[model samples]
Target: MFPPGFFDRADPSPDHFFYAPPRLVTHIDDQAIAAVGVLYQELGMTGEVLDLMSSWISHFTDPPERLVALGMNQVELAANPQAHEWLIHDLNHTPRLPFDDNSFDAVTCCVSVDYLTQPIEVFTDVARVLRPGGLFVVTFSNRCFPTKAIRGWLYSDDASHLEIVKRYFEAADGWAEPVTKQCIPPGIPGDPLYAVYATAL
Candidate 1:
């Protein structure tokens, strides 16, 4: 068995919940969406980017030359206007990625980091696929499928969740200094979302 806190085992069978669902909705609200744009602005535009764990939409404001998406559902990825190419795969089943070393200029995982059961290995692979000085970005909100979210995530606070993603960057050996951003839209009437980012070491 995996370590106690490494993953939430109560929802061990996410495929059962994931396979049949098709939520054609954006997880974050308008304010949060704008906040993502602001975050992406800081990331800078004009390079190849990989949208890891992407869905029906990618909140990237500035268009890049190439945007690739790797997701669980092809329909969702196809619906994403920003993705030029998409691959369907479950990272929980295979933490390894199929891309060559230093393939992407940047990587973005949006709103789906809480579902990972094998984050460390995935983070390591992300580091391997990114070019030197390239970036890895992870964004998440307070919304998730309750039955599918892991037990650890279900009980954790917003601060702890940010720390969890930060730790993923830290545990990945080749990541440069990682920065965590709190996406607290001022005077917003909803759950708080956060973004954590890092550059390749």
Candidate 2:
């Protein structure tokens, strides 16, 4: 079980209040973004892909067939060139996805996993959407809006953050052993990158 106040944020304000205005900025630096792209390519994330908590750029060099980018901001999703279709959705408000079961080959959340108030529930929905053998990749950086990040995320270090995400996958069904790895490009002096991913069973 999770600790008390695990999901609470410093700013207990509504998520919609903070996300009302669209931010078209990139969260991680170029090298970090490239590292993420390399990881995606290495994992062979193809076919119908779902980008959860996505932004303007997916960092995907070769786009998938049906790339669905879902996020809170409409403008951010609208600006995404790789997304065949983008939807405005709030995971905190509703952890369940609108898609039918086993709809995607891969699902990725880039540098935005810390904000989830209901991570386990969201991960369960991720399992529901992913086809068997599909990947659920959740990547994050050392940076975040401290006020918006959950208490567990804000209080934990990078290693602990990976464990937290790993636990989320373990708490849900239809997932194989989660893989935790560093995505920071070697010799790149910038934001640290990390990922915890698993394959749907």
Candidate 3:
């Protein structure tokens, strides 16, 4: 749990305005991006997958049978070659997901978890949409749009960011114990990658 102002952002404008323009850039470096793909492969991320808060790239070395991307920018979602289906949806505005229960085998949010103002609600919905024992992988690095990130995320360090995401799954109360990992080795790269993931109960 966090304080009242924890979710507030420096830029209080609607997320649509903030993400209106398509920025087709990779937030993390090549090494960090590779680490993300490796993690997905290690976790056996296949079947129907939901890429939440996605952008122009899913970063999958081997994409799943079906990949659905949901984000705020249509152009970016459309540009994702790995995505089998894509939609423009704002999680901050509406935490409820449009998919039916048990629709996905796995869900991923890459490098964009900090922007979620209603993370717990979104996480709960993610759980609802996932089948039992489905994995929900959340990966992130230090890079972020500072003005759009939550106050708590902006104020926290790397270790605290892991704890914050772990607590999010806990608060949602529909996941198994979350596992945190340093995807990219420390002190050897452009941007350090971290992950906090759990399986839906």
Candidate 4:
């Protein structure tokens, strides 16, 4: 378990107030963006990818051949030029994903893991939907809406955040050992960019 009271303090209102109107902006700074780009390049640029909790702008500098986005807001998903296909669904409402087993070659959740109340189960489901040797990558920075982010995420330190996400992979059962990275670019302000990624067993 992620510890009781971890996600107990979030507002109960529909996430629409927080996400209904599209902000249409990148959450990470320019330096951080470059770091993410480097990480993506390292991940390689082939096969179908599922962008979980996707938004109007994916961090990648170029488009992939096949990109599928899933998220809560339809308008935001619709506006994203990177998405080859987009599906509207709230993962918080239904953590059991609708995708077929072993479907995606790679999966990404960018800056949105803080909002998940059931991260372990969702991570387990991620492994189920990923093909053998498929990668599940989660990236985040310090920027977040404190009121909307889950309770556990609101107070956790950066090192603890890494451990927390690592635990998600561990609890998922079928995921191989995760590789943790701090995507820091020189002279960037605020917290360093971080990603915890692993291959499916």
Candidate 5:
């Protein structure tokens, strides 16, 4: 388990307040976005996909059959052309997902895991939603809103960040050995992208 106050954010303000404006902006640069798309292609994310804590741009160059976006702002999600459906929810306040068990073939949280306050519970729920052999992919870049990012993420480097996400998978059941990948090649001028993924056992 993480140490006390590990999940505390610098800004204690409600997440809805910060996200209410519906900023339809891409968090990472084009290079990082392309890297994310390549990572998704490697994962073979073709079936139903749930984009948790997603924004307007999911970074999925090859869109899935059915895409659902869940996040804090409705306008941003609405702007997502790839998403067939959208839901507004605050994971920090309610980690429980609003979906049936084994509902999706894949679950992805893009550039937003650091904002989660209850990661273990959320990860378990992610596992529950995935079918057998289904995967959960989490991708992140160097950039983020510092005030909303948790203390654990704010203080950690790129390697430690991967370890933290791996531990989240370990803490939950029904997950295979997590595979970590460097989406962008080394010494990139754009944001450094990384991913940690695991399949349902």
Candidate 6:
């Protein structure tokens, strides 16, 4: 659904080097973060959960029974308080997840999807790892590292971002009809939160 250079980035260097330092800061504001938590709760994100592309905080108000975080930086993943287990992995280099089939009940990627150069492969692997009818929730905002973010993401608006993620799920082909929502209401201050989610088939 995108052009040849859509996934290209300004910084074409290795992702590990870009994420070497631990960024403990939250990308979105408190309100947007709270909205993410509320969405997770409402979606019944229980059981074994995989926090994909996770950082120092999972933003889960009440975490699930077992939360495993997979990210690029070891220090950042290790610092996540909500994660019961953590793995240092880069989806940009290896789109295939190192997890067993039906391993997780829910998978979440927050504010990090824009950096993925191989999102379709990652989404397909996410579906493979999820249990039947499990949720794959991808939340994002306008804020992103311009140098690392995909050209398509940097060029697109919020509505286009939602459609982008939705198309990813559709292309993956193992998910139910995706749902898109504006998690944070309009006219609210700070970064806006939006979600594109679907259930594994």
- Which candidate achieves the best lDDT against the true structure? 3
List lDDT for all candidates, in order: 0.82, 0.91, 0.95, 0.83, 0.90, 0.94
Q: What tens digits encode model 4's per-residue C-alpha lDDT throughout 123-144?
A: 9999999999988889988878
| Tens-digit lDDT track of model 3 for 87-186 | 9888988999999999999999999999999999999999999999999999999999999999999999999999999999999968999999988756
> Positional deviation of 162 in candidate 1, in angstroms?
0.9
Clashes of each: 0, 0, 0, 1, 0, 0
Ranking by lDDT: 3, 6, 2, 5, 4, 1
Query: Which digits, one per residue and each the tens of the lDDT, describe model 1 over residues 26-62?
Result: 8888878777777887779459999888888888788
Task: State the lDDT at 84 in candidate 5.
Answer: 97
Per-model TM against the reference? 0.92, 0.97, 0.98, 0.93, 0.97, 0.98
Tell how far residue 180 is off in model 2, in angstroms. 0.5
Better of 4 and 5 by TM-score: 5
lDDT winner between candidates 2 and 5? 2
Candidate 5 global Cα RMSD = 1.0
Residues 1-201 of candidate 2 have per-residue lDDT tens digits of 898999999898878899989999999888889888988999999999999999899999788888999998999899999999999899998999999999999999998899999988999989999999999999889989889999998889888998999999999877999999988833568988899999999
TM-score result, candidate 5 = 0.97
Per-residue C-alpha lDDT of model 6 across residues 80-192, encoded as one tens digit per residue: 99999999999999999999999999999999999999999999999999999999999999999999999999999999999999999999969999999999856787889
- After superposition, candidate 3 runs with Cα above 4 Å error: none
Candidate 3, residue 171: CA error in Å? 0.5
The true-versus-predicted C-alpha distance at residue 71 of model 3, in Å, is 0.7
Worst 10 residues of 2 by lDDT: 182-191
